[model samples]
Target: MATNRLLRTAGTVLTATALLLSGCSSGDSSPGAAASGQPTNGRTGSADTMPEAATATIKPLPTAVPAALRPYYGQKLTWRECGIVGFECTTMKAPLDYAKPSTATDLKLAVSRKKATGPGSRIGSLMVNPGGPGGSAIDYLQQYAPQPDAVRARYDMVAMDPRGVARSEPVTCLSSAQMDGYTRVDQTPDSDAEVDRLTSALRDFTRGCRARTGARLGHVSTAESARDMDVLRAVLGDDKLTYVGASYGTFLGATYAGLFPSRVGRLVLDGATDPSLPARTMNRDQTAGFNTAFTAFAKDCAKQRDCPLGTGSPEEAGRRLTALFKQLDARPAPTGSDRTLTESLATSGVTAAMYDEGAWPVLREYLAKAQKGDGSGLLALSDSYYERDPDGTYANQMFANPAVNCLDLPGAFSGPDEVRAALPAFRKASPVFGESFAWAALNCAYWPVKPTGEPHRITAEGAAPILVVGTTRDPATPYPWARALASQLSSATLLTYEGDGHTAYGRGSDCIDTTINTYLLEGTPPPPDKHCT
Candidate 1:
């Protein structure tokens, strides 16, 4: 099971939920900046000056490619039709340890692309990544890509699964059965024995990851993946990268821009994550974000008929939901299957629905069912969140999520005592989901690999204007992160969507879509103060 700090894309969550019903499935510290619907730090200059200023400010890449890295960068991609009709897939090579490059140490990475259906000149590849630190970029590209026809007509859409993620030498830990049990393990433990069991499960998970994944475990950091993206950029014949990254992908994109500022071209970071926060702060803030999202859901639910938590204030709704969680904790609810819905899974189910408001109605139904001693609906939602197929198998995302997160930064808490110490604040941030998210944040503490990166700001100086998009009530990445990231990047223009869900683009907002599509097509970012409802 991945930590609750997981930065998931809205489309991926909503899309997975759609399949499951059918039968399948941050950090900024600025006063008033995080919660505000409006952009915080405004970009200088008027709208007319924005386009030229953005294009002209970009720094040129060095003329020569590093001699040591040229072979990896210059290697040809032999694309073949990979089942999906219009999509082509290929494997690209990257040095496992960039510090030491050789054929013996090469790692094969999966790359996929759909060539432009053009009436206009090609505008290079529009690379995309849909968060997860572990979510498959190739899978996301297949499911949701080339969203705008005009943009698709002018650019080849491309995606590369980052190292240790889906299709790119994935990290696998638990078996299907192990994962099933792992997911059901009580995250919000009450007794000392339960706490020990939870900690034991985490230790075993980390051990399995270390035992199953060897040296490659140490090489899956976002920095390494960012470097791999540069190689992909060179191989694709693009002097600069034009890209869209959502959720954790925002962090990946920001890392790329920071690492290779001169090569950034028309980058879009929607549902932005703040790279400046430590693991603890990120997890805690995400807890608060979920609180904000659920409050929105509760308010909407209260106005509807047969609302599970009744038509009262959000606090009342939260209390009713909390009572349901307690009931499950004591006596697991039957889901018609052998796997009963424990409080942990129940929490995950509700948390999953909080990602996109489209799932709100479904959440209401599931909560109603759970109240009546039926947990199947909520279990399905949790299964979708974990990407567990009907066959009981699981995706590699859960494994890769921690592998990358633990390496990216230190653990949120070192031990159970620390978690207990921190629970008050976590609960204060989120009265309902806080305790579970707080304990979930402990997954990285047991990781075998020590962290290679730490909390820091990403300036991405001299990078061509990067659009930092945020949704006000975004559960995963939160709105304020967009503000913080925009302020950090020297050339970023903050675009706000005063709405619900994880991301703004393609989520029924013409304003958000037009602003992003225009920027990608014409390199003209919306004014920094732009906020759409």
Candidate 2:
């Protein structure tokens, strides 16, 4: 199978979820004025900005278990075949509130596993997540995860849908028709009236989420999900957890290590995120990352005869893309379907291509077609990015993406006023994406569930060695983030893939695959500062 999938904040629905964390968080609000995809001193921040980490130092988890939580700690799981031949599925319950476990509502989470195909003794359960804060870990495992035989032979590959994500109790907002209108709404507003319209739509979106999902929204923070990981680990009879996470999954894995450092076994965090940065900085850095990725794409495209952006320097290609966006903004292109190619959809399609270079040929094919006034190719790309079905129904990924992102960090900006002020920095970061991404950063501003999580450094102190992978020109999670995250963790080895794409693993570098596989199977980590071109 392919290494599989991921997205950033503000890019999901109308655009796509910036859950944009990997590419969406720092990858989400269109990265700000920073050196695009380059490393700064122990910080992957917007240009010269450094986001403030959470001030409240959470007390270390207690060694002794309390009575109310013991039921969760000791709960038994009933697993049954999920019809996937080898995989099994089950549901586990967690307290809605970790602080008040006995009084709060119980949460049911979905879990799936393909037990070790062992010729070797089984090590334990190896959990995986494909990032997106909203990406379906279970779905990723079923579809894309490259369960290298060596690792699969020694571990039960498992995946869980964190609370408020797919299969678990999901949070929802807009209906299909409502989402259609929302997606077409202008993201790059030029007038006060247009800005007002955008703000109103945002309010309505958040309001819909609040009205439909209720109190449960507040509890879906990454911290809570990390705790859930501990619960899952204990229930799986593993004293220590073995995990492979990419992009935002890195953040989730790091969070788990921070909360339960003693319970970590072998962990791989690919396309890592720097949790210490504030949402705004994350938005900006991600914007820069995309800029870098686009530069790469443009350079490559300029070589192809069918390249729509043309054979000039990458600078020229960027200009052409900018013009196309502006044109689409004024007059959306026609798709074969009823939907016209709005600027938002077009941007989403472009960003989707940034995730993987393998998609570039396809992007070129569509861009060539799009330049001729035919948007079927671009529209199809956008539809794929949004995961829109032929019936127009969307998978819950986009909806759940914001539900988690809004809860994970404070809003990048409180309102349009804040966003307008921040736009210069965003634009300065990437003249192409800065404005819309800046506005997109305002995604969580009206979240009904006040932010419970905050920018915080995760040391995962006293934990086993964790391997963090980064692709230098990765559109979503930049190389600097891998460096930043590695520095944050006390015991982490940095693995660098000097290449392009959203993530590095299982995307077919024998070097990357071998390095990661050796670590997973033999408890070995690549040389502390490993680099794979």
Q: Which model scores highest in lDDT? A: 1
What residue pairs are clashing in model 1? Answer: 20-25
Listing every candidate in turn, what is its Cα RMSD in Å to the true structure after a full C-alpha superposition?
A: 8.4, 6.1
C-alpha TM-scores of all predictions? 0.90, 0.91
lDDT of candidate 2 over 1-533, digit per residue (tens): 00112342123211112246311242111011011111122222332344554433222365566787889989999999994689999999998877677535899999999999779999899999887777888888876777688888899999999888889999888798888787777878999999888878888888988888887877777777888888999899999999998878888888788767888899999988887777777778888998998899999998888898889988889889899889889888999878899888888777777777778888888777777788777777776676677799977777777877776666677677776777788888887777777777667777776655555667767899999998899777778988988988889999999888777788778999999999988989989888997
The Cα error of candidate 2 at residue 234, in Å, is 0.6
The superposed Cα distance between candidate 1 and the true structure at residue 234, in angstroms, equals 0.3
Worst 10 residues of 1 by lDDT: 16-25
lDDT of 2 at 127: 95
Tens digits of lDDT, candidate 1, 1-533 = 35432223222444211100000002111112222111223222211121111111112235466688889988999999984789999999998876667899799999999899888888889999887768888988887653688888899999899999889999988889999999999988889999999989989998999999898898887777877999999999999999898887888888788768889999998888877655676677778898999999999999999799999999999999999999999999999998899898888888888888888888898899999999998888888778788899988888877787777665667778877888888899999988888788777778888766555677877789999988898877768878988988899999999988878777889998999999998999997769998
Off by over 4 Å in 1: 1-64
Pairing residues by index, what is the TM-score of model 1? Answer: 0.90
